[model samples]
Target: MSMNKEGRPTAAGAVTAIRTAALLPDEPLLFEIGDREHSGVDLPEVEIGEDRLGGFGRRTSLDLAGLTEPEAMRHYVRLSRLNMSIDAGMYPLGSCTMKHNPRLNERMARLPGFADVHPLQPVSTVQGALAVMQQLSDWLMTLTNTAAVALSPKAGAHGELLGMMAIKAAQEARGEGHRRVVLVPESAHGTNPATAAFLGYSVRSIDARADGTVDVEAVKAALGPDVAGIMLTNPNTCGLFEPQVIEIADAVHAAGGFFYCDGANFNAIMGVVRPGDLGIDAMHINLHKTFSTPHGGGGPGAGPVVLSEALAPFAPLPFLRRNGDGLELVEHVEGEALGRITAFHGQMGMYVRALTYMLSHGGDGLAQAAKDAVLNANYIKARLEGTFSAPFGGQPCMHEVLFDDSFLEGTGVTTLDFAKALIDEGFHPMTMYFPLVVHGAMLIEPTESESLQTLDRFCDVMLELASAARAGDAERFTAAPHAAPRRRLDETRAARQPVLKWEEAEGRAEAAE
Candidate 1:
C-alpha cells in the first residue's frame, strides 16, 4: 500500500480499491424501477357525485405506475445518501451561507400550531402565529435599528426588488420620478443588477479598488440627478468589508437618491453592525443566511426588508401591525405605500425556523457566531495563503476567504478541474469564478459550524492537491473526481444547449437514432 503525504494510508486510495473490488450499482430512474403490475396498496373505488365534480370529472383511467413499499423506500433512501448537505459535512460556499441547520429550529417549526395553520385562517383563530411573526419582525427591526420591515419578500433577490420598489415609491412621492439609474458595485451579488434592471432602472457598474472594496471616489463619479440608488453588498462578494460604505451611502443620499443594501452577506455582521447606522435607507435581511433557515434548492426562504424612517411609510402592503387586542394585516395600499407583493404572508415555515435560530442564539451568542465565522475563514486563509493566491491579500476578511487561481498556473489544472478534484477529497468545492472581478476566483466560506479539527483535515487535503499540481502531476488534477458517481462533464456545452426536460432528451435520442 502506497503511503500518502502524511506517511499514512490515503482514504482516496482505499476508496479506489473498494471501487475496483465491487463496483457500486448505478441508481436507476424512478420510472426504471417502477413496475406496471406492482401495487403497494389496494383501495376500494369511490363514486364521485356530480355535484362534487361539476362536470369536470375525468372518464378515462389515470396513467399511474406502482412499486412495492420496500422498493419505494429504498429508491429514495439511496438518493438521499448521494446528496451533500450541511448535515453531512462542511459546506464552504461563499456568498451563499450554507451553515448547519439546527435540529432545535426544525423541531420548533414542526410544532402543530405553526406548521398546520392555513394562510386563509381567521386572524382571531391564529393569534399565536401572528404573535410569532410580529415578535420576529420586532427582533429584525431591533437588530438592524430600522424603523419598519416588509416581511413579504420570498427570497434574497425578491427582497431586493421589494426594497427597490419601496425606494421608487418614496422617490415618486417626493416628485423625484426622473431618477432612473441604479449604481451597483462590480463586486455586488449577481442578483443586485438583475433586480435593479427588473424594476426598469438602468444599472451602472461601480469599480472596486485594488483591495477588493468599492472606492468612494468611484461612487462620487457615478452620482447624478438621474441616479435612483445604489445596491451594495457589505463584507462584499470578495469577502472584504467596504470600509468606505458610510461615505458611499452619504454620497448617494446627497445625490437625491436612496441606498439599497444587499443583505446576502449579513451572516458575517449580524449583531456586529447595523446597516442603518451606516446611512442605509433600505436593506434586506436574508433569513435563510443570517438566521439559519434551510437554504438553496429553490428554497422556502424569507428575506424581510428593513427600511429606515425615510422609506418606512412606503413599505409594501400586507404588513402586520398591532391592533387593540391582537395583530392585524394591512392588505391594501394605504397612504404613500407600495402595493402588496405576494398573495399571502411570506414563508411562514421559514419564519418559524429563523425565529427559532435567533431566540436560541440570543444577543451575545449571535455576536459570537459572527466572530467565529470570521475567525474560521481567516484561519483557512492563513493556512493556505502560501499555497494559493488571494486577490485581496493582507486584509482581514469578514466571513469568507477569496482566492484567485494564479498559483495553479502552468499546472494544466483549470478552476473547474480543481473543483471537480475536491469531490475525491470528500468535500464540496468552494464557489468558483464568481464575483467576476477577479480572475478564476475561488470563494470559500467555512461557517462557524465547523470545528478546528474538521478545518485542519480540509486544509490538509487542499495542501496535498496544491503540492501535487506544483510537482507536475497533471493527471491528479485533470482526471479528477475518480470516486464520484458521475464524471467530469462538458459544462460549457451543457450551459449553451441544456436539455431542460426528459422529453427533450427523448427527442434528441430519437433524432440520433
Candidate 2:
C-alpha cells in the first residue's frame, strides 16, 4: 500500500529488505539447480548385455542431479566459504579443543607411504604405515605413562566404549563380573554415561561440588560390590582441574572399582601431567584434540585408549606390537582383549597426523602447548572477569573458561542471544548451554592456537557485547547476526519441522532465512 497524504502507516506487511552484501547468497541444492541428464564429463557409452547384480538390479531411476565440472566446483567452494573453520579463525569451542592443526601434520598424513597403504595390505608391505602407528602409540604411552594403547577405537566415543569394555573384561577375568554400575560425574563428558549405559552398566550420577569439581564423598558413598568403575574428566567441563583426583582414584581403587578418565580435556595437561600417575585404569586420548589433527568433521578421528597394567591385558585387538625386526598388527583378540572395535586398524590418516604433531613438537613442545592452552584460557577469564560471569570465577582455569548468563540476567539477553551477536562481529560462537550444570553455559577454549592479538580482539568484542547487554540493548542481540553470511535461525522450529529431502517443500531449505 502506497503512503497516503497523511503519511500514516498502512496495512502493507512489507518485510524490511536485507542488503545483498550482508548475505552469503542462496546456494541452491544440486537437485534444485542441476539437470538430471547433465554430465560433468562425456564418456563412451558401453551397454552391458548381462546384469552382474544377479536378480538384484535397479528398478527405478537414481534421480541424481548432475552439474558441469565448474558448477560442481563452485558449489562446494561456496559452501566452504560459508563454514566457520579454525583455519579461517580462532575456534574457541570449549572441551572440543578447536586448536590449530599444523600443516606439517597434514603433509605427513598425505605422504605416499602413510596415505597410500591399505589396512588389508600385507604386514611386510605396510611397514612404514605400521611404524607410524607404533610411533604414535609409543608417544601416547609415554605421554600418558600408561601400560598399553589401543590404537583402533576410531573416535572419542568409540574409545570410551573400548575403555569401559576393557574394564569389564578385566573384572570378568578376576571373577568380579557381577559389578554392574558405572559412576559418572555430572561435569564429565556426556558420552561417559552413555557409554556406560550402552555397555549394560547402570549409571549413577555423582554431583559436582560448589566449585564444579566432582564430590569425592559422593563417590565413596556410591561405591559397592556392584560398582564397576567411575568415569571422570580431569580439567573437567568447567575447565578446572580436579584437585582431589588422586584421592578419588584411590577411593575407587579401595572399593575395587576402576577409574576411567575422560581424556577430552587432555590438551590442558598433556605434558605437565600424566593420567597413569593419577591411578587412572583406562583413558581414551583423542588424537585430534591433544596431538592436533584436523578435528570435528565426523570423520578421520582417532581416540587410542591408554591402559593401566590391570586393564592393559584387555586392551582391544588390531593394536601394534614389536616383532623383533619390524612392527606387526595384532589382528586377533588375544588373552583378555576386547576383540575388534572397528572393522580395520583405525584411521590411518589420523595416526600419521598425530605422530607428525608429536615429532614436530617433541616432548617439551607438547608440554608448552598444554601450558599455552591453559594460559590462553586463563587470559580469556582474566579479560572477561568483571564483564562476563565466570561460573567458577577467581580460579585459574585449564584450557577453557566457563561463563554463565548471570550478567545478562536483567538485560533481557540470553547466552544464545549474545552468541548470535558474536557471529555478527566476525567470530564463531562459543559452545553454549553445555555441561548442563551451569545455567546458560558459555564454554570457550582458545587452545594454544590463537595469538595474543586474536585473544585481545575476541575479548574486546565480548566486553562490548556484555556492555551492550547491560545497557539494555536487547534488540541488538535479539535481532543479531544481522551482518553474518546468514542470519539467526529458529532452531526449535527447524528441528520439529525438518525437511530431510530435497523434494520436500521447494523453499524449505530457506526456512532458517
RMSD of each: 8.5, 8.4
Off by over 4 Å in 1: 1-25, 35-65, 68-70, 297-299, 333-336, 504-513
- Tens-place lDDT per residue, model 1, 1-513, is 222333442222111111222434455555455433433454445885555676697896443435545556776777677677888888898888888889898899889999899999988888888888898998898888899998889988899999999899888989998899999999999999999999899999998899999999999999999999999999799998899999999999888889899888888988999888998888888888889898875258889999999998888878787899999876866464667788889899888898899899998888899999999999999999999999899988889999999999998888878888888888989999998999999999999989999999989988998988888988977888888777777789999999775453574354345
* lDDT (0 to 1) per candidate: 0.85, 0.85
Model 1: colliding residue pairs: none
Tens-digit lDDT string for candidate 2 (108-211):
87788887888788899998888888888888999999999998987899999999998999899889999999999999999999999999999999989888
Most lDDT-accurate candidate: 2
**Model 1, residue 149: what's the lDDT?**
92
Q: What overall lDDT, based on C-alpha atoms, would model 1 receive against the true structure?
A: 0.85
| TM-score, every prediction | 0.90, 0.92
Scored by TM-score, the top model is 2
Q: State the lDDT at 467 in candidate 2.
A: 90
